[model samples]
Target: MKIHMLPTGDEVHRYQKSIVIPFKNSRKVLSTSPLNGGYRENLLSAFNHDSNPGAGISCSLRTDSYLNDLKLLATEIGLDPATATGISTAASMDNVAIKAVSYENLTVTAIVTGGVEVNGGRVGDPASYHEARGKTVMTKEGTINIILDIDADLLPGTLARALVTCTEAKTAALQELMAGSSYSRGLATGSGTDGTIIIANSQSDLKLTYAGKHSKLGELIGLAVKPAVKEALFLQTGLSPKSQHSMLRRLKRFGITEDGIWNKHGVLGEKTLAKPVFIQQLESVDREEELVALTSLYVHLLDQMDWELITPGRAAQEGRYLVERIKQKYQLDVEYTFSWQSAEETITGMLANFTDVIARISAGGPDV
Candidate 1:
């Protein structure tokens, strides 16, 4: 292990598969770690570990045993096992991102390691039933883990508030990237098994009473965390705005699949073109900026209707208008009729019809 001292006088030990931060002095800590979690005044160190269990290898560490395992790791790293708190992930430690920001007198730092391939999910999405306690069931999958440090003293309640600010910033980052939920037709807020730790300086004389959105501390926390999480995600999984620029990627949240579109194309009796040709043309059109922009608007309309900000009738009207614009712009000879069935049926029919039209247009020409 090699030690690198942070600007806040903390030493970060970088091991091959872990990053450990040992404070020069005991610090105030709050975390969702399975070990040494919750409020603590005498924490000596914090760490993030990568337990990369490969294929056919079991990763689910029993809770009773894993606690001792982490403690053993702590002791090996010259930290007091009784005073160390940490989180774990399958993301590579080499991809960790460290970001720091400062105002006139306050400094905030965020360290993040993120991977959202298998577990990305939105809040309120349906969940699979699982029962476990304290680090048990360590599945070998993606997760986002964050570690935060503040250079100034803060009240215990204020530290808790900082955690909230950090969480919101993380979600905002995922939203900006348009990350899709694994379980629903919604944008992911975070992975299902994410963890976070927030530490504040107990030795500093500058004490803060609040860390809400209005506070400078909160602003710094957001500034540090959002971009750090984004960078870490990109490093771990190649997710970025550029990677999400396709219409298919945008429409995937609505349960749109390539095979679904191809089936819809066959149903329309448009078998003149080969399936490979249709797919090639579809890929070409999927990247068109104007078409993607229209798709984005249509998706937002669906979202607005779902949120009750707009009526289904209004959304259908606007969606059909957008389709007309696409037809005119592309000069395609596709036809669609609106269904006034139940709201669910109407929405489903509209999406099916729209996707079918898109498939026809893609099959018609290369310039579409």
Candidate 2:
């Protein structure tokens, strides 16, 4: 956009323009967080949804499907936490032939295949079986090889093993859920000189210039620019050492350089650096000059710029398109990844841990 500059004064000052871009939409698939975990709260607060009208609404996680997957994995080994604990404990105890442990009220029975009974007529005796009484006639004996099954003094470490397995399985499921949603993008910016101000009686046009380009929120995240000054030529014309000193001080403060002729930027002042001659002149001149006086008194700003383009929806598809376009045109690899867990998956995983455990079953007989 082109802007007209009117006469400010013999002396003038300028400022550099900068651009900022704050938000950008992402095209990557992100997992939603559980409703109860307050992940949604965190996301909404980050975007400042309440304060900013443009900011979109909050999104929710997809849980049912995710939980189903967790359930499937949990039952994969036919080992609930309870069963797993029993089997693991049995294995550790060297009770090589243990098959199952059933709990009835306060009593727990260890089922063995190739062992004799423990309490019956075989306790402490070099009976047919070791550490147990052999099953006798009519006792449902398998294979005429008199076998004995007995419970160990210490039961299987069922509780601990079951807890560990369930916790581990649930955690894995949670991760999978989260991996489904998370994202980020880049910002764009610009820089240059804009507008003019009159400083002093030098009749120089002030210009704002930037050493380099700066990026802001594409929208106004905030504004941070200093006003341009005008050297008071009146200091030289009239006897206002106070004004001259102030102007000089301002020049020093802004680190303004003199190019012999006039400061292209505004002149600095300590406090009230003499009447703004350019503005005064414009007031006396035409309507156009008056307009310049109003705008040229301070630093001018454009708008914010953003490099990212994140909108809601088909993230993968949009991401592919964005990446391809960026690579093809700018030869830039504008690729980013995001992941998130759904509300259902997150809660379900936690519930699964709370509800189930592994069950251990040991087959009696030889190592086979």
Candidate 3:
């Protein structure tokens, strides 16, 4: 693909391009497919996706049939199916994994999973182990584990851009089910401004399946998986007493019985709780930008979390469950092995802490 940028102004340029792709031993053809949206980014070589993977996106709907046709589709798009590898989900009686193919530009050097569980952190134990971990949330907060690996060249000073592009792509792929949910950086509600991030790198490390690839296959897969991870996040509904206590703790300053925060995207009601799959049934005609905006707001909402309520040492990791499910339901058996960079329970211990937590849970905690 050759891109021609002619100066339209000191800082802006009009872009024109043509991509020549040879298909299945056929002659090369000049393809002039227009990139989505007429605008361009200020960043050099920055690519954005509308988050819609074509051919009706799905992870497990028809695994056998899908994989069988994947090669043909890859060839159609001028991609080498062999390089279209990396992660695959696998399940066993004991555990589930998302395995990577080979090292790509951006590799998965270490994975430090973070989350919260009231049961594990006994009373006053101050289990600081979970403390240092990242991205903690309440019971009502449903989230997914996204093992992302951007191009090594693109990693410099591109944190916010990469995150935005990635989030937008994923949200667009999910379309509706995730419309009600939001995400934040840092630890839960009250934690500092620490967005989801990468911590390490090396000369040789495992690739994140199709991560960091510049290929169209990699791009589509990335967008699809972000929403797919939603299923896993939904399963993380085991509200913790400490997490509840922390969530309710916010009320101490206002001295109110109800949760005051307002952004309420993923709150679950009794019926949805009873019928877990109901969460998946929810759909959206909302645009990709809306979900991306929601995620940005999630980063903003981190200020409300009472970090004091989280156990000191017990960070929780919950994506493996989804990996297993994808394998079981979709036949996408590829285990995920994050560089073992070392890495939850209980509700009723609830009343003991926040008297009104039941009400908040029942009513769906503050959307803010």
Candidate 4:
């Protein structure tokens, strides 16, 4: 919320940068047994058995506006925030960044990202729950793991789609932040041309081989705008005056007005979202510092997989193992492995959703 002043005259306006959101820790509180025991003793017994009453969970986010906006959008679309962790927004700013900061206000104390490392520390809490006769019931009880990341451009408040048009410019400005030598200098560069970067060196050859590797990066960027570009043809004949104007404004950013709907997806293909990559570094020695280590590892692994870029079988395998490890190490209670897809899938699904929205609007337009 405050601007950080640099040694140079100009100010580096850094926002709160990030916030950590915590999952619920409360359990169902049980009523005291009346006939068997008195209220206080009954409550004590329950507590002693590690089945005591639980406090109500706090409503999570620090800002009511965030919680409300998320719930409102979810309600409007008949979506469950829990089920569809992904959201489709035409807003200019990166909704992922905004929501991430918002979630930070709730329960996450610190966050970690990047690949697994011995320094990443062990997953699972050391805290233990005990039952009657003082036997340990659970090593760690009620700890929920959270994995989240943001991908869209500059995060803006809800507005007319005109704001979404601004994403192109906003994203460009954001990329400039990393070019600053302070963050880039000695870090492991992914390749001579590939903008993909890894921060530190590792003895692990898989990482070292790709340390500065940029293979396939350019090819991927070339494919970035395919879906959006493909949707533009519908705009020519089907778009209403207002929608057509919006489409034109977006086209202008990519210089596609001249090329007739060139693939602009290339723009996003250059770099993955900032948050996941940023978190990966933290994941290195993160376990000792935080509880969300599993979530961070999950996101980092998901990033490496790049959901759409990986085969479905590989993705399914990664997803399964990631969930399985969390379950085994943390003893977590989760719905199922299949319930959570790679983060890549979430982004791809989001893009598909955006394309669908554009198509629906085009079909419903007055011109149509």
Candidate 5:
């Protein structure tokens, strides 16, 4: 075990299985942890544990009592289970990220462990249809667990407001990476099983009343949480902006898939290319900076049309312009065509045409 000291004079114990922050005195906390969740002032410690059940073990075969399991974990770590509240994730503690941001005397630290291999989703996405009695279903796949500690005292309202700020910051990190939603044609805000814990010093003399975006405290929180979440995600899942710079990754939210692209343009009636050749050519140009830029603009136009911020005709006009730019940039001879159907159909058709042109160019085929 390794120990690190926080700015608030508290010790953070980093163990092989968990990260524990034990409070020396009473502190105020607001959390979504299943063990001792909600507002609490007498909590002794906050923990983020790795609950990975190992390979080939199914969820049904795991322990059904989460609370009891957490209690046992707390005791094993030498923390009083009765006074501890915490969260758990399938992500390993080896991937935890610790970031601290300070302004003058105020300091905020964020500890995050993240994995989004599955269940990454945007807010308001579809839900899994199920009903459970007594115990709820838990998956040991992906979760982003956050623990925040503020050195300065804050009102209960401010602490709650800080939660909102921290959550927004987390979403901002995901947006920067353009993380996709599993359930919808949109970007993911967070994983379905994400959990957060926020702690504020109750003994500090400097008390804050507001933690909204307009405040410096909120700014610090964003500065700390956003990069911490991103770093944790990178450590745990190899997910970073560099890793997400693929045309397919960006277009997946719009219902475009590798097979969809390949099947749409892999063959021209009697002529066909091998699947490997097609994918190689497609991926070769997918990361072209210029092409990716045009794709970003095209998707933004789609978003604007969906939000009714731009008329369908305007989107079509601008979209055609972008498509033309793609052809000109790549020096590919292709014709511009639209189905003149619904706005969605028209815009998606433009994308399909754009992709088809690129694929043909990549395969060294004559313009159609």
Candidate 6:
């Protein structure tokens, strides 16, 4: 792999810096798969400290050991000189920079300087899927700069995680390129990893600019950690995680949404639905019982009704129509609407209303 020149501070802000990792690659055949060495080194460099006098850049500092580790990493991938992101350049330096900047809140920005065209391009023709690395490969080399803004502390291997996110983005970009949709299409053969050195300068750059509106890196980071956060939150509540439907309903009722975290649920509240107290009450009504009881009550009321009032035929017809509508649709809709809000409350209100009507009808109250 190549060792690129140390980056000048002027390229970034006080809060940001950049470094380049130079790579040596084969001119004859570029491998199309992951670089075992490159992938692993990037992860370590992200977390490892500087070997010599510390440079102002966040990641530029490298020691003899770090460099040796790179060489060793290449061996681990065990790719021929044609495929690995090598250690030195000329060899010439295969330099690429991964810059990071800390923001006001709990966040850090990791930027891979180059774009899709450089990073996502392919290298070698397909080796036999089951075959070993080629005897010898041609040599060509280039750089792809990737960027990311991490929303957390400088945890160990954070830099490596950022690199992984970059790899993912590159793969996605490659897919689009293969499908004939990217500008990088038909130009490059593979990502250069041979004889490469990464230089990270002290961070001085402040603002972030990207082609897309949102940081694709942040999205990946969120996806990586969201499940764990969710599980932790759910466990704290002492409720076994439920189906997504129930979970979302609970979150919504607790005022949780994409708008951002808010303790809208207060410090804590009674998780009524979390308990089984109302499960039986909310059990679906016996539709046949509702129908039979209403129908019999209607007949009894008719026997006691005064036919002289408001044209009995029309009145009876309208009454029957209202009963059918309630039985077939309106009552069901009301129950659903309430159930969605809170099954307990919906059932309680429903039963109370039904009972009131039944009592009034049994007492021979006004048909109106």
Query: 304, model 2: CA deviation in Å?
Result: 34
How does model 3 fare in lDDT? Answer: 0.26
lDDT of every model, 2 decimals: 0.83, 0.18, 0.26, 0.23, 0.82, 0.30
Better of 2 and 3 by TM-score: 3
Q: Candidate 4, residues 124-189: lDDT per residue as tens digits?
A: 212233345554221111111111111111111211121222222222221221111111111111
List runs of model 5 lying over 4 Å from the truth: 55-61, 130-135, 365-368
**Using Cα atoms with residue i matched to residue i, what is each candidate's TM-score against the true structure?**
0.92, 0.12, 0.23, 0.18, 0.91, 0.24
**Backbone clash total, candidate 6:** 80
Off by over 4 Å in 2: 1-156, 179-368
> For candidate 3, lDDT tens digit of each residue in 1-368?
32221111111111111011111111111111121111212211111111112334422422233233434443444445443211111111011112222233432211111112111111232223463565332211122223333223332333334444444543443333322212221222211111132211212232232223374434544543443333332234323222222322232222222322111212423332322222222111112233334322322222222243433122111223333432343243244332222111211121112222223223332221
Cα RMSD for candidates in order? 2.4, 41.8, 20.5, 28.7, 2.7, 25.5
Better of 1 and 4 by lDDT: 1
| Residue-wise C-alpha lDDT for candidate 2, range 1-368, written one tens digit per residue | 11212122111111111010111221111111111111111111000000111224222212243233223322342323211111000000111121122222111111111111111121122223332453321111100010011111111222222222222322232222111111111000100101110011111122112111131110000110100000111111221223222222122212221221022212221112223533233223222332223212210110011111322223323433433442343233223332325423322332222111100000110111
Worst 10 residues of 4 by lDDT: 192-201
- Candidate 4 local lDDT, residue 55: 36
TM-score comparison, 1 vs 6, better candidate:
1
**Worst 10-residue lDDT window, candidate 1:** 131-140
Best model per lDDT: 1
The true-versus-predicted C-alpha distance at residue 363 of model 5, in Å, is 2.1
Model 3 alpha-carbon miss at residue 241, Å: 29
Off by over 4 Å in 1: 1-4, 55-58, 62-69, 72-79, 130-140
Leading candidate by TM-score: 1
Q: Per model, how many backbone clashes are there?
A: 0, 86, 34, 25, 0, 80
- The weakest ten consecutive residues by lDDT in model 5 span 55-64
Q: List ranges where model 4 is wrong by over 4 Å.
A: 1-291, 304-308, 333-335, 339-368
